[model samples]
Target chain A: MTAVPDPTAELPVAIAARPAPGLGALFLTCLKIGLLSFGGGLSGWLYQEFVARNRWISDEDFASSLAISQMLPGANVVNLVICMGDELRGLAGSVACVLGFLVGPFFAVIALSALFDSLPDVTMLEAASNGVAYAALGLLLVICLKGVQRATKFPPGLVVIAAVAIAVGLLKLPLIPLVLVIAPVSVALAWRRS
Target chain B: MRDDDLVTLIAVFVPFSLLSIGGGSAIIAGIQHESVAVHGWISSREFIDLFAISRAAPGPGTMLATLIGWKVAGWWGALAASLALFLPSSLLCYGVIKVSNAHKAKRWHKAMREGLAPVGVGLVIAGVISIFRLSGGGLVAAAIAVASAAILTWMPRFPTLGILVLGAATTSALYSLGD
Candidate 1:
């Protein structure tokens, strides 16, 4: 599984049609991003590697993938990887990218679990972790604000943000029902505006 | 790991994955309900700790599944839980992307994207509030969060890990001094 994708083999016409990078290169790049990124800035790491450094995808393509990722479910970073992988190298590439991205953290979290078990008395470690968690909230708040700015081009977009915050955040309604109710309304409004 | 436990992991996470519509934040309450109350895999306090650790760890915040599974049933459980939560949603996404690509310029696609953008933002804000509450909503925690947000807004290029380390060191020093 760790073998490099053959650079010279006759790739299937489907894969050959796209300006695809080797699966090995895609996996390694994902692995590097996974291992190096910390404290919840995975997207920033992804943007740097895929868009800025390597130019594997253009800025617009990255933004579009990010939009799709956000619009769908699960983790935005994971979805983003899936979209990038699909675009670059199809289904196998998508699987490889996800595995590459997740493998490091999978092992790291297991190691952390072991460490937590051993350091039962490390009150300071707990405190530091709390600090980091709270700080990550700060990062999240900025991202939310930026997202709001992006969404507000249409007038009803602000309304959707407020309604969702109230319904899901304050009212504590469960999300699936809330989304089922609000999503259609927001989409209709967007359709009208369009 | 017990076979029953593996089955339970699958049953709990698969539905949660489908419900994770906006992102990981959307399903936090559901996961908490299942893991802490319904299944009794971990205590509520332990749930919070795992949440914090998962948040602070690299990779997706959804790795909380891996941690929860690891805690409950070792490596096999971790494997089962992560796949259950991740696989279905990803496959759905792949399918949707394929369909959406065919209709790339359709008005409905635009509407869907526009409609969901704000909801995605709202979910993230809710996440911030939840984390703030989890951190005990202390004046120091609030101050750190607000200050960090302000600084990051001012300097969009600031290194996030640097800010994380700064927050940790500053809080740790305060606790040491208090003690």
Candidate 2:
């Protein structure tokens, strides 16, 4: 019989894979992710941290984890934190991850709320925000395109679904009705093909 | 507010946390149902406005929990609502991670990923469409979306805050001109 490839041997020797991060480091990383994650780059950042930077997980595993996070309830990023924490350090890690992720945003929101009075009247601030919104839309589009490229092996069906969905949405069709119509048809096609 | 009111607020948000499948936007319907239809905490117009603010805010859209909580029950309420919205799902996710690690490379895990990807794409597209709709159908809004998409594709190095500020300024300037 041919020798089976050793998975462990394939691991990068240059990158020392430590055990899960300590509570403080975990908290700090999560906080940084939270603060820096403007307009939702949280998933990409998580992939970089856990998979590319830390080498704690593989890309396939990260993709799968992200999938599960999206499927589950709560914010996808928060779910991912729990997933990563549990994988690394069990229960306490999970708690720490959640706390770390939420703390920065929570305080930031509270602080911003206090500044409600001046928010609308501040023209420069409004101008800055408008710029941010435009950039956010760009970031969001890139993320979506990347996601589409990754997920779709069958380009034809994928393009069709994307185009149809975009059309319906732009036409001002109600979301619920569109979902009800497209979801089942897509599932049926997938089922039949499988 | 009374203790019962606090409990009711928590009850509304807790289930919402669980049912929010896609993210903050996914829970909008549920939030509207509970806050407007059932409890009468906020009117439809107010709910819609709150959604706009949440989307425009610099942080997670779920920060609406804090806003609604503050409206309903002051500081304590805000804290409670935020926790309730986040904790259950966070714990559930932790549980999922534990189970997934134990069952890595299993067929079900792979299958679940395959199934979720399309659904997620659909959901996200739907969300974008809905946001566009909410911005109101106009050449200006369409131009904004198209121009934003093109600029982002070309020069992603541009800060997001800068883009949003520009959009708001353009809109405000146009509005002023119309007056």
Best by TM-score: 1
Query: How accurate locally, in lDDT, is each candidate?
Result: 0.75, 0.64
Error of 2 at B49 (Å): 5.1
Q: For model 2, how does the per-residue alpha-carbon lDDT over A1-194 read when each residue is reduced to its tens digit?
A: 78665444334323555576788888887887676555444564565466545677544345445546766789877887787787777788778877888887777666666675346776555444544444345444544554565556655447545754575556655444554565555545544455
lDDT of model 2 at position B126: 53
lDDT of model 2 at position A179: 48
> Using alpha carbons, what is the TM-score of model 1?
0.72
B7-94 per-residue lDDT for model 2 (tens digits): 8878889998988875777887888888888889889987776665565454578978877787788878888889889888877776
**What DockQ does each prediction reach against the true complex?**
0.40, 0.27
Candidate 2 is scored at a TM of 0.67
Best by DockQ: 1
How do the residues B9-93 of candidate 1 rate in per-residue lDDT, one tens digit apiece?
A: 9899999888787678778888999999998999999999888777657788888998898878899999998999899989988
True contacts kept of each: 0.61, 0.36
Candidate 2, residue A90: how far the Cα is off, in Å = 4.0
